[model samples]
Target: MNRRRFLQSSAALSLLTAADFAPWQAISAFARELDDFVRGPAVKDHPLRQVSKHVWMIFSPDGFPTPENQGMMCNITFVDTAEGLVVVDSGTSVQIGEMAIRQIRKAFNKPVIAIINTHYHGDHWLGNHAYVDAYGDSLPLYAHPGTIQAIQGVQGNMWRTLMEQWTNQATIGTRVVPPRLPLKNGDELKFGDVTLRMHHFGVVHTPYDLCVEVLEDGVTLIGDVAMDHRIANMDDGSYLGTFKAYDSLEKMGSRIWLPGHGEPGAGVLKWNRRLFEGIYQPCEQAIKDGLALEETKARVLKDPRVSSQARDTKGFETNIGKYVSLAYLEAEAAGF
Candidate 1:
């Protein structure tokens, strides 16, 4: 049979040609099924929610690291400018990035002028593959210098390990793509119609972290420094610096806030502050009482005030203890 007939006859088209279309002929129907199984709702259900005229957000609820969400436990924000588009944080995998691109196409056909990663985490920047696939090397990714260093160094390896462990076939085509452009504190970037004010709160969520404030939209993408419903993950940061970062964010006076995770994007600074203080004070008292890490963890978890902040997610339970232990360590290292 001819290649087309063989394809129509349901032969494995791999035997036909080395052409890209051959692969599609073989797997198109099955691929659609698999894609549906892995990916979340189409543009209709998870459509980008508008924060402002220029600012839009896609919020991903906390859940297992499936292909559907691509470990995008955090929210992704995009800004439309007069020139093109600016993505606040890419998704967790190549597929997620492609989905971001599709969503962008659904709204605007402009080129992505920049993708600014608030930090080095893969969930925030790994979806770079989609942009890279579309624009190739011309796509300029911006982040703090520390972000590049960490991803190029140890944290990059850590993310790979975690994705492999948690995701199913979701992470199959995704790999780490670190940012290329290094941004500094107080740097002003004018891209189309919006100006980005990149603010770095010293040694907060990550040693190299930043929050992008959209000067035109009056919205600030505060990265992971603040979260809603879930207690902040203390796996890669400091208790003292977080409080300081919160102080800085609260003073930004932006009309709207976008967190790495959460809904509505408003009052994030206040909610994170309350959770941070609630967890910190008890942690300090435990350290002052000469409690060990384990004891401090126990005290923090049992504390009626902060216990409510620990959230439960699919395949994972919020371990408030880790936050407590990290807080104790940060306090001890700073001699506070």
Candidate 2:
């Protein structure tokens, strides 16, 4: 069948399979079902929530599945300074972005002089238009050059697919607004007393994955790089690269980690890195042993390291299975 027909068929089959499973069966099921859509509803309580003295986290309950439960959350930190405000990743939607702006205004009257996009993912950058469109071109937005390309490349498809999947609304056409300044690795942005160092690890989670480290606060807002110990999404073809990025973060030990999803914590970098190495390495090794796919999966599932995190293992297993299939294809290509 043609590509379009195949995608349609696959989508239908997936929907059917999901219907058979329990509603809210697992985060994996929810994510797969909502893969094409932007997560969460708009939250509108301003007056920024203070995560730290110098760091204020504007919580946008946008991507959360439930209105009361804050799941797919995004955070923006503000540094108290005379220069201007430094905002981190914008949430998934226009409403979320606007809400965050209102909160930022309450905390500091100064203009948001700069914004650092952690990556080009829609949830992170889609709300950017809301900021620029409101503040005019005065405020500069920074991201890796790869981020600019990815955003521009997926603009049309992102608008169409997101509307169809999330809101169940169809669009005739759509346009994407790009960020202002393209950032490079080691780029330093300063606002009054706060200084943020941008680090670009090429092609990790995404082609332009960027991490923002607040020197004074000692907090690092890692886009989607060091996420919670759930299944890592690799639909964008950066599975191996993502694992490598996780390794790098482990080495750069930090006190606090602000991930894209879940609550912020300390020492999560070590936990996340260990999980990737323990899980991915053995799985890759099992494939090399010429084990059948099912057998390999069963062996990995029963392994002590795997069973420890098995409660959150469903999504990991699903993603790893796909990775295994892809690895097999690569081996075949190499005439293995």
Candidate 3:
């Protein structure tokens, strides 16, 4: 099922218990169980559901990585075009990426013409190894320039190293393959039957974040810019950039939206604004008054509009702290 139906269904979270996990434990659970997630069970082939005739999205469950849920905490989107296949954001590792590609081949005969990396996050692009190995490195991969530069530099290597340690040894041969194509904002192209319009906003979710629009189907493939139900990590995210991305999406007026994480829909953008604003006003005020990091975090946690959905069952040190810390840093840097 697509994100819309999956999230709307009462059983969407049947297996996951959304308790607060330590940042490392919740977000990097995949690294901890890399072996089990790759070789343990039927972890690879989750389910790939159709968003449109030309679009299919693999919706991951909502929660930090865990053995029970595996490391499929992020969604993968693949599109079928007239000429070939187009993929957006590979999975976290070689195994997960392989499973996604296997599922893609099961449905069509098209050779993948392009793979798009929405940002610099390893989970979104490290799966590039699988596609490169299968289709050959000549297969054109697309991403923002900053994303390409980061992956080709030491920053990418550090993220890769961290992934290997977190997944135990499961990430062993998963090379960090940078995208071959640098896509500019508003670049439009046609692949078979679908028409693609690219969108870029500076330093919202990351230095290089790209969203795509399928003009043919009124569908938008937005990366990590928008999230629903849960609080998104803002350590590298910008409070103002997030709102700018939302405004861009609103202008596009697409009925279908596939998020990098969380369930897909227009609602994702709507709630993103609410969450950021709730944290920003409180955090901004604290920073203006010369409150310390800990004090700012405390103020954000007390504001339920932002923290209520993301609060853990027993810990005051919630994922909300990640947002608070990031927002506070941005405020200080901007001289709020």
Q: Which candidate achieves the best lDDT against the true structure?
A: 3
lDDT of each: 0.73, 0.62, 0.75
Residues 196-231, candidate 1, lDDT per residue (tens digit)? 899997887888888999987778888887776666
Please report how far candidate 2 places residue 18 from its true position, in Å.
47
What pairs collide in candidate 1? none
Q: Write the per-residue lDDT of candidate 3 for residues 227-302, one digit (tens) a residue.
A: 6665666667789888877887798889977888877776778777877888887878997898998988778767
| Clash list (residue pairs), candidate 3 | 31-166, 31-167, 32-166, 82-192
For model 2, residues 66-162, the per-residue Cα lDDT tens digits are 3342222455556555687777777655555667777776657788777778776666666665687568767687788877776778652574356
The global Cα lDDT (0 to 1) of model 2 is 0.62
Question: Counting only residues 3 or more apart in sequence or on different chains, how many pairs clash (N, Cα, C under 3 Å) in candidate 1?
Answer: 0
Which scores better on TM-score, 2 or 3?
3
Q: How are the candidates ranked when ordered by TM-score, highest leading? A: 1, 3, 2
Clashes of 3: 4
What is the TM-score of candidate 2?
0.73
Weakest 10 consecutive residues of candidate 1 by summed lDDT: 36-45
